[model samples]
Target chain A: MMEEHKVIVELKQIATRFGDNIVHEKLDLKILEGERVALVGGSGTGKSVLLSEIAMLREPDSGEIELFGEPITQMSGRELLAQRQKIGMMFQQGALFSSLTVLENIMLPIREHQHISGSLLKDLAMLKLRLTGLPEHAAHLYPQSLSGGMLKRAAVSRALALDPPLLLLDEPTAGLDPAGAAAFDDMLLELHAALNLTLILVTHDLDSIWTVTNQVAFLGERRVLMKQPIEKMVKDTHPVIEAYFANERAKRAIRQELI
Target chain B: MNEEKQPPVISESSDGVQLRGEWTTPYLKQLQKISKNNTRHQVNHIAIAQLDPNGSRVLLELIGNEPSAWPEGLTKEQRGLLELVREKVGPVPAQQESVNLLAALGQQVFRVIRHGRELLEFAGQLSALVFSLIRHPRQLKIKMLLDVLQRDGLNAVPIIALLAFLLGAVIAFQGGLQLATYGANIFVVELISLIMLRELAPLICAIIVAGRSGSAFAAQLATMQMNQEVLALKSLGQDPFAWLVLPKLLGLMIVMPLLTVLSMLTGIGGGMFVAMVQLDLSPVEFIQRFGAVVDPIHFWVGLIKAPVFALIIVNVGCMQGLLAKGGAEAVGHRTTRSVVQSIFLVIIVDALFSILFAQLGW
Candidate 1:
C-alpha cells in the first residue's frame, strides 16, 4: 500500500538534541501524498519540533529528509527553496507579518514565488481568503484586529497562497472555542479535499486529532511510538498511547462521537 | 525543466489562441503579458504539457468561462487539473479605492498627538503611583528593587568604567597635541578635568545606561506585556507600575549619581595616565594640576544632571515597554524606540542644564 502511493515526505533516522537534552532519536516517518496526519505527544515530546523538521524550518541533528522524492541535503539552495515552496507551514500563533493586512499577508508568499501582476495577485489572494471562509472585508484588516478564529483562518489563507502540495499546521485549533475549532476542522477538511493537500498538524487537542486527521503519529521516549489510523491507534497497548487515549477528556470525546 | 528557456508560447489561430509550453509560476509574467493584449480574445485551447496548481489557477484566470472550447486530445490529467482550477478560481471583484495622501497624513498627525497624550497620561499615573508608594512604604517590593538596582546599576559599572576611561584618554590626547604647540601642556589637565567633571562623564554614563539598561527595561516589559503577564497583574489587582516601573525608576535614580561620580574619577584617572605617558608629566603632577584647576562646582554641576538623566532613561524605557503591543517584533520596536528616546531626552535635558547653569554663572 505504501509502495502504491507516492511519499511526499520521508524522514529517516532523525536525531535532534539541544545540548544534553535529546528531543528525537533515530526517529523515522513517511507521509504519503494527500494524507491527513496528526502529530500527538505529551508537553515535552517535541511534536512541534518534529513538525518544524518536516517543514524544513529546522535541520535534524543527524538524519535525512526527502521532500517529493528529492533528498533535501542534496538539493542546491534554489532547488531547496523550490522544494520549500511546495510546502506551507503555519506557526502556532498564526505568524502573520503584523505590518501587512490580511490580504497582503496572503499575497506575500504568492508574490514572492510567482510573477503575476499586482491586481491579479490580489485577486488570487482574495480567492485564498474566500476559500478559508474569511469574509471579503477581512482582507483589509490587520492580524491584530482579527479575533483568534479569524487570525487562524487568515493564516491558513496565507499558507494556501502558493497552493502547496503539503501543509503543516502547528496547533491549528489551539486556544479556540469548541465551535470555532469544529468550524476550523471543517474548513481544513474542505481545503484538503479541494486543494488535494497533504496535511501534517501537531496538536494536543483530542477533538482535533479525531476530527481532522486520518493518521496519528504519537511521539514519545525520543521516537515515534506509533503511527496508525486514529481508530486503531486508540486501542494500542503502548503505555503512552494507552494513557493518552484513556484520558478523561479523550473518553468523553469518544463517548460523544465528537472525535 | 530549464524554465527560463521555456517561456510560455501563445499561438494565435482563426478560432482562438492556444497556450503551449510549461505554464508554471516562473512563467506567470509572460502569461500576464499575453493575457493583457488578448483580454478580449477567447482562450480556445490550453495545450501545456505541465501545469502546477498556481499555473493552473493562472491559466483558468486568463481564460474566463465562456462559450466553451477545449484542446484536441487533452489527457484526463490535464482535464482534471483544469477542473480543479475552475472550481477554485472564480471571478475576483477588483479593489477600486485609491489612497488619499492628505487623509493618510492627517491620520498620522492624529496618531502622533494621541501617542503624546497617552505618554503624558502615563507620566501622570506614574507620578501618582510614586506618591502613593511613598505614603505606603511597606508596599514596595524591596527584593525586586534590590535586584533591579544590582542588575541595572552594579552590572553597568564595568562597561561604564571602560567607556569613560577610553573617552577621557582620547580627550587628553587630543588636548595635549594642541596644548603642546603653545607650551601649555599643563592646561590639558584643566581641560580634561573640567570636561570630564562637568559634561563628558555624566553624558557618556547616561548614554551608556540608556543603551544598556533602557533597552533591557523596554525589552523586558514589552515581553511581559506580549505574554499578557502585565494583563495578568492587572487582573490580579496589582498595579504593574508599583511592582515593575517604580523599582526601575528608583533603582536608576539612586545609581545614576553614584555611577556619575565613579565615571568622573575613572575619566580623570585615564586623563592622568595619558598625560603621564604622552606629556612626560608625573602622576603626582597631573593630580595636583587637576585638583587645582577643576573646582567643586564643576563636579556638582555634572552630579546634579545624573538623576534627571536617570529619570529620562527609566521613564522613556518604561513608557515604550508599556506601550508595546503584539509579538516579538513589537518588543524589538519598543526596545529600539526606548534607546532612541532616552538618548534624545538625556541630551536635551543636559543642554537645558547647561543653559540654566550658565545663567546662574556656575
Candidate 2:
C-alpha cells in the first residue's frame, strides 16, 4: 500500500449527486504533492467525475474535499473560483471557447486575475503559447481553424496561463496519433519535471499506464481496486485488475509473437 | 450458443474492436423506449397548450405510452391544433376579394397622395447605432446591415404590396357598398379613390413593415439573449450592449421605412388589381383622381412614422433576446415575445400617429 498522509488533495468520504443519480459515493481519495497519479477505470466509473468534483465544478453532497489542506466544499463562489485559478484542468473536449482567438483565449484568464497593460498581457500570452510548441503567429487565428491535436495543445497552454501548481488532465492522449500521443506524453513529462507540477491524469489508455505514470489508482465497480506503483499494481490480484489485463487482445499479441 | 450469449464480443472483424451485438440490444431497447415516450410526451405538451381540454383529450387517445417514447418527456404538443385546425379548415382558397377595379382605381390615386409619416421614426432610432459603430466597428458591420435590409426590404415587399392593394380594394368595396345604398355608387369611386391616395395605402404599408421586420428584429435579439453569447462577452470583459444591441437597433431604424414604402406600394397594387377588374375603373382616371387627392404632407406623414417602428423593433427585440435564459429554448421563447410585442407596439405607435395626424387635420 502507498503512504497517504502527505496529501495535497484529500477527500474524506465525498458524496455527489446529479438530480437523484449518485455520481460519487462516500469515496475517500488523496494525492500528495508532486505525485503523478493515473486514475483508471471502466466507462462511467466516476474517474472524470472525481477529477471534476475536486476541480469544484460540481459540489459534493456530504463530506469534504480539501486542496492543500483548504476545505473546498466550504468556499464561497469567489473563493472557490480563486482556488480553481490555482489548479489547471485540460478537459476531455479541450473545452476552449469556440469564438475566441488563440491569444485572446490564453489572455482571458490572465487578464481576469491580474490588472496589466495590453503589451505586457500580449507578451505573457505569447510565452504560454510558445511553451506548448505552437507558433506565435497561430495566436491570431480562431479555434475552428485548428486541427484536433493542435486544439488539445492550445487548451493545455490556456490551462497553464496562471502557472497553476496542480494540473488535472482528462484523457490527454485520447484522440492523438501514436506519434503525436507519444510526443504529448513526453511534453507533459517535461512540463511536470520543469514546473514541479502535480499531475492527476484520468485515462484508460493501457499504453499511457505503462509509459507515463509513476503511481496508479484503479477505480473499479464500487471502490479503489488498487492504489500503488505501476509495477506493483500489475502483480496485485484484484478481479478488475485480472479482467483489465486478461483480455484476448493481450493473449493474441502473445500468440502473434510466435508467428 | 451459451458462449455467444455471454456478451462483450471483441471480435476480430475488419474493425479492430467490437462489443457483442447483445451489448447494444439492451441499449437500443432503452433508446426506443425513450423515443416513444418522448414523442408521446411532446404530443401531450403541445396538445395541452394549443387545444382545448376536449380537443386535447381526443389527441391523448391517439399517442400516450410514456416510457416507450422518452424519459424526460420532450414536449408533445407543438404539433397541436395547427394540424387539427388544418384538417378542419380544409384547403384554403386564394384570396379572391383581394382584388377589384374600384381598389385598382383607388391605389393609383393613393400612391402619389399617401402620407408616409412613419419614415421619421426609423430615421431617429437608426442613427444611434450608426454613430456608435462609427467609433468602433468589428465583424458586425456589413452582416448586420445586409440582414436588416434583406429582411426589412426584400421579404416585406410582397406582404406590404398585398396589404396596400387589399386595403385600397377594401376602401373601394366598403365605400362603394355604402354609397350604393343611396344610389350614389359613382360617388363611391370618388370617396374610395380619394381616401386610398391621401391616407389609407401608405398607412397600411407602414403598419405591415412595422409588424414583420420590427418583430423579426426583436425576436432575433431576444434569441441572442437566451443563448448567453451576450453574457459570455461580459465575462470576457466585453460590453454586450454596445457590441450587439445598439448597432442592430440602428440598422432596423434605417432600413424599415424603405421597406414600409414598398409594402404600401404592394398593398395599393393589390387594391388596383381589384379596382381595375371588379369596379370597371380605368388606370388613367384613377391616377388623375390620385394626383388630386394626395398632397406632399399626406405622403410625408406615412414616411415619418417608419423610424419609430424601426427603433422599437431593434430595441425591443434585442432586449427580449438579451433577457433569454437557460439555453436555446429560452432564445426561442424570447424570440416569440419580441415579435409579438414589436408588432403590438408598432400598431399602438401607428394609432398615436393617426390621432396626432387627425388633430393636425392635414
Candidate 3:
C-alpha cells in the first residue's frame, strides 16, 4: 500500500509557537494518500495545532508544508484558497454555525464553491447528511438541537460537503460514551473507505487509536517522536512512546489488537 | 538544503522553458521578467528541477496553463519536488479593479436601509408576541413578568425618587432666583409644578429606566446568548420573543407610568422644600398655590409618554441583546450598544412627543 500510494501531505522542519511557548520544533512528517493517520500526544503537545496547520487554517511559524506535491508557503492567495477547498476540516467542538440549520451548514461550502441553485444545493447538502447517517428530520434542525454524537456527525457531513480528498479531524471523539466512541470510529472507517479520503485525526483515545488509524504519530518534546504503523508503534522502545502505552488501558488495547 | 548548493537556472529553448536550481522568493523578480518577455510565444513545456515551494509558485505563475510536459531527465526525488511545487502553485491572481465611489455610497445606503428594515421587523415580532399573550392570557409567563417588574421597576423606585427630588429642588432654586428680581416669588410654585409634571418627571424616569433596566435587559440577553441558552430555547421550539422579550417589554411599560407618577410627587415635594428654606414660603402656602396652578392636563401629558418611552427602551435593549454574537467581548459590546441606542432613541421619541403635543395646542 505504501509503495503504490502517493504522498498527500509533507511537513519539513515545522515550528509552531505561541509567545514563549513552543509547541513544535523542526517537526517533519509525510502522510500518504488514502492513509488513516492518528496524531497522539499528551496535553500541550500541539497535536491540534499541527492538524490546523495541515488544514491550512494557520501557517506554521517556520518550515515548509507541501500538499499534493505543491509547497503551500509559496502559493498565491487564490492558489491557497483553491488548495484549502480540496481539504475538509472538522473542528473539535463541531464548529457548526449556530445561526444555520444542519442542512444549511452542509450547503455553505458547496454554495461558496459552486454556482448551483438553492434547490440543488439543498439536495446536495441533504445527500451529505444522509451519507453521515443522520435522520432525514435532522436536516431542518439547528446545530444546538442535536445531541453530541449527532452534532459531530453533522459537522462531519458539512466537512464532506465538497468531497475533498483530504479530511482533518481535531479530537473527533473526545467526548462520547465508549459505545458511541466505538460507533464513531466505525463510521470514520466507513467514510474513509467510501470517499477514498486521506484522514488525519488528533485524538487521545487509546481505543480510537487501535480501531481507526493505520499509522500513529506520537508527539512529544516539541516534535513528532515517531511515525510508524500502530503495530510497530505499540512495540516502540522510545521512552515517551513506552510511557504512553504503559498504562493498563493501553496494555489491554494492545492485547486486543494482538489477538 | 541540497538545492542551495546548485543555483536554479532558467533557460528558454525552441520547444519550451527549462527551470533548474533553487527557485525561491529572492529570484521572483527575475522569473517575473522572463515570463513577461516570453508572453508573446506559446511556451509548450515547463521543466522544473531542484525547486522549493516558493520557486514552484513562481514557476507555476510563469507557466500559467500553457505547459504541455514535465521536466526531462528528472530523478524520482526531483519528480516529487516538482509535484510539490505544482501543488503549491495555484492559478494566477485576478487583476485588481478600481473602486467606484458612487457604487460604494450606494452600498452604504443599502446597508442603512437593511438595518432599518430589520429593526422594524423586530418591532413587528414583539407586537405580535404582545397580541398573542393578550389573546391567550394563559400562555403568558406570569412568574417571569412579575420577576422583571420586581427587578426593573420595584428596585428602581429609590434611585428614581431621589433623582427626581434633586431635579425639582434645582428647578425651584433656579426659578426662585429669577422670580425674586420681579418680586414674583409666589409664582415659583407654578413654574416648578408645570415643568416637573409636564416634561421633566416622565423624561427623567424614562432616561433612568433606559440606563438601568434597558442595559440590564441587553446584558441579560447577551449572557444568555453567550451561554447558548437562547439557542437552547430555539432548539426546544420555544419562542424567545414571547418567553424572554415580551415580559420585559410589558413589565417596563407598566412600571414606567407608576414610576412617572412617583417622580411627579417627589419633584413637587423637592420644590416645596426649596421654596420653604430659601423663599420664605410655608408648606401650606406652597400647596395652596400648587393646587391652584398645576392642572390634570399637565400631569396626563407627561404620563402619556411613559409607555412609548418604555417601548423604545425595551425594544432597543432587547434587539441589541439578541444581535449579540461571539463571546464575553461580544456580550459587553451588545450591552454597551443597548444602553446607547436605548438612551438615544428615548430622547428622540421624547422630542417628537413634545412637538406633537405642542402642535395639538396642549
TM-scores of the candidates are 0.82, 0.45, 0.53
Per-residue lDDT for A1-259 in model 3, tens only?
Answer: 5444788999999999999999999999999998899999888899999999999988999999999889999999998887887788999889999889888899788777765446445655766686677877788788877888899999998997776778899999989889988989998997786556799999989889889999999999998899987778877888888888778347777678999
Chain A: TM-score in each model: 0.95, 0.90, 0.95
Top candidate, metric DockQ: 1
User: What residue pairs clash in candidate 1, if any at all?
Assistant: none
Per-candidate chain B TM: 0.83, 0.56, 0.72
- Measured with C-alpha atoms, the lDDT of residue A190 in candidate 2 is 68
Model 3 per-residue lDDT tens digits across residues B1-362: 11234455656676566655545333444545554566555444444444433344445545553333543555555455445434332222233455599988998999879877877888999888888888988767789999989998999999999999999999999999999899998998999999999889998998899889988899999999889999899999998887899889889989999999999999989999999998988999999987887778998999998998899888888988888876566778888888887778778888898899899988
User: Quick one: best TM-score, which candidate?
Assistant: 1
Say which docking band candidate 3 falls in.
incorrect
Q: Model 2: number of clashes? A: 81
> How far does residue A23 in candidate 1 sit from its true spot (Å)?
5.9
Estimate, for each residue in B1-362, the C-alpha lDDT of model 1 and write its tens digit: 22344677888888677888876666767777877777666666767866665666666656654315554534676666667556655544455577599988998999989877876787788788889988999878899889988998899999999989999999999999999999999988899899999999999999999999999999999999999999999999998998889998889989999999989999988898999999988899988877776789999999999998988888889999988987688999999999998898899888999899999999
The list of candidate 2 runs beyond 4 A from truth reads A1-6, A76-78, A248-259, B1-362
C-alpha positional error of residue B277 in candidate 2 after TM-score superposition, expressed in Å:
29
Interface RMSD per candidate (angstroms): 3.6, 29.2, 16.0
- On the 0 to 100 scale, the lDDT of residue A97 in model 2 is 79
User: After superposing candidate 1, which stretches have Cα over 4 Å from the reference?
Assistant: A1-30, A41-46, A57-79, A217-229, A232-240, A247-259, B1-30, B33-41, B45-53, B67-120, B179-186, B234-237, B273-294
